[model samples]
Target: MPLLFLRRCGWLGLLACLLTACGSHQKAPPAFTASGYVADRGAMRLWRKDDVAQQTVNIVSVYSPYKGENTVITRYQFIRDDVRQINRTQNGEHPETLQIRFDDKGNPSFMQRQRDGLREKLSDDELALYQFEARRLLDVSQSLRAGQVILMQGRWRNGVMTTCDGNEVDPDFDRRSASWVAARTQRSTGQLGVAWLEAPEGTQLLLVANEDFCHWQPKKSEL
Candidate 1:
C-alpha cells in the first residue's frame, strides 16, 4: 500500500510539472488595446470615431498652383454618424487586421492624416479639439485589452474609377453613394461624369471614407 501511495504521489508531481511547463510556454497578449492606436506600415492614416463631428464641422481653404494664376476652393466638412477608416498608411505594406469592435468609443486617441508618401502628418486643428471633446464624452476610466487579430480577412466587390484634373475614367454603379447609383447605372465611363445632382454653385462637400472610396454630400449650409 505504501508503494502504491508513492506511485500516486509521483504521478501528481509529474502532472504539476507538465502544467507549469505549459503555462510558461504560453504567450501574454502583445499589447493593451487601450494603448491607443496600433502603428502599421500599410496604413498611414488613422482616425478615431471620437474625431467625427458630434454635430458638424466645416473648413474652407484655398488651393493655388505653383505657377498658374488658377485657384481652387477646398471645403471639408465632418459630421456625426459618419464612419470612416481609422487605419491605413498607403505605404504598399501588407495591412494587418486587429479584429476590433470599431463602435467602441475613445481609444485610438486622435485622427491622423498622412501625406507625402507617409513622410508628413497633416494637422487638423479642429480635429484636435474634437478629440478633446470625445475624451470628455467617453468614460475610459476602465482599462481594455487590445483587439484580437483576424486570421481570415474579408473580401469585397467594388467599382473603381481613377482620374486627374485633366483626365477622366468611368466605373460601374454602386448604391452606397445614393439610392439611384446602385440601381440605375450599369456601367460608367468618365470620372468627371460621375452621377451629379444640381445645387447652388457654392457648396461644402462632406466626405467620409477609407482608401476604398469617398461618400460626399453638400453641407446643409449650402442646401
Candidate 2:
C-alpha cells in the first residue's frame, strides 16, 4: 500500500512538471509592436504590424508639431522588406495628401498628390525623397525596437491613468508636466487621454488630449 502511494505521488509530480513546461512554451510572439522617437520640432509615434503569412510589414507614423497645429500621418507598406506603398496625409491650414504605390521591382506604379483642392503629380525628386524617407524610417524603427523604446497611451481620470491594455500606471512625468496634464484633464469635458514614450534613457510625455487615441489607432487588421 505504501509503494502504491509513492507511485501515485511520483506521477502527480511528473504531470505538474509537464504542465509547467507547456505553459512556459505557450507564449507566442506579439503580432504587432510599437516604438517612437522625439523629432527635432515634435514627437513621432510609430506603430508596426507584421503579417507573417503574407510576408508583409506595415508601419504608420504620426508626427505632431510642438508649435504648429499641423499633424502628419504617414503609412508605409512593405512586402518582403521592399517598399510596396506609401500614403501620407497632413492636416492643418494647408492640408495635403500623397499616395504612392511601387511595383514588385521597386518602381513606382502609381503616384498621386493632392494640395489645396488641386491634384498634382509628384516630381521625380519628391518621389525619390519619399522613398528615401520610407527606408530611413524603417531603419530607425529597427534601432528603436532593439533599444526597447516603446510608446504607450492611456486614459487619464482624476489622478490615475488606465492604460490601453487595461493596466493602471503612474507615468513618469515632471511636476510641471503632470500639473499641465491634470489641468487639461480637468478642463476637458470628454475623456482625457495621454501618450508617452519609454526608453532606457528616460520617459517623455508625448501628448494629452480629450480624444480617444486608441479608437482610431492602427490595428493588426487595419495594417
Candidate 3:
C-alpha cells in the first residue's frame, strides 16, 4: 500500500509539471494588428490595438473613395466586445464630424454631429446605424485577421520604398506594376505614398499618391 501511494503521488506531480510546461509555451495574442478590404466604390484600411489587461480594443478605419475626393475616417472604442464610443470624420467639399458615446448599459450617453460648420442632432435611426456599422466592421476585422490579410503603407522615393514604420521592403510587384509606380513617382513633385495589401496568395497595390499617409496614421501608443 505504501509503494502504491508513492507511485500515485509521483504521477500527479508529473501531470502538474506537464500542464505548467504547456502553459509556459502558450503564446499571447499580438497587441497591435492591421487589416483592410476593398469597399463597394473604394477601399478601407483598418488598424486595431488591444489592451489585454484592460479588456478593451481600439480600432481606426480609413475609407477612401475611388471617384470621389472625400475621405472618411472612423474610430471605434470597445470594452470587452461592446462598443463604448465612436468618432467619425468625413473630409471633402462637405465635411462632417460625428461623435457618440455609450453608457455601461449600452445606452447612448452623448451624441453629436457637425456638418458644413453647423451643429446638428443625430436621429435614433442614425445612431443605431452607426452602432451596427461598428459591429459589422469589428466582424470584418476578425475575418481579415483569420485569413491572414495584412495592410502595409510606405513612401516611395527614387525607386526605394520605406514603410510607415521606416522599414525598407521590396513589394512583390510585377514588371508592369513596378514600371507604372516608377513612372508615377517620377512625375510627382513630392515623394510618393504607397499602400498595399499582402496575403498568402499575392500582393495588391491599393493606393499611390503624392500625399503622405503616414502623417495621420495612428501609432500604437495612440491606439
Task: For each candidate in the order shown, give its overall lDDT on alpha carbons.
Answer: 0.26, 0.75, 0.77
Best first by lDDT, ranked: 3, 2, 1
Worst 10 residues of 2 by lDDT: 1-10
Worst 10 residues of 3 by lDDT: 1-10
- In terms of lDDT, model 3 sits at 0.77
**What digit string (tens of lDDT, one per residue) describes model 2 on residues 80-179?**
8888999999999999999999999989999999998799988889888998888877766655555455789888886788888889999887777788
**Please, what are the lDDT tens digits per residue for candidate 1 over residues 1-223?**
1111112323334233334333333344331111111111111111112223255323322222223333323233334532221222222232221111123353333344444434333345644454443332121111111121111111112443332122333322233444434332344322222321111111111111221222321223441
Q: Which residue runs does candidate 2 get wrong by more than 4 Å?
A: 1-29, 186-190
Better of 1 and 3 by TM-score: 3
Instruction: Flag clash pairs in model 1.
Output: 33-145, 33-146, 42-89, 43-88, 43-89, 44-88, 44-89, 169-191, 170-189
RMSD, one per candidate, in order: 24.0, 14.6, 14.0
Output candidate 2 Cα RMSD: 14.6
Q: Clashing residue pairs, candidate 3? A: none
Q: Name the top lDDT candidate.
A: 3
Model 1 has an lDDT value of 0.26
Give the Cα error of residue 217 in candidate 2, in Å: 1.4
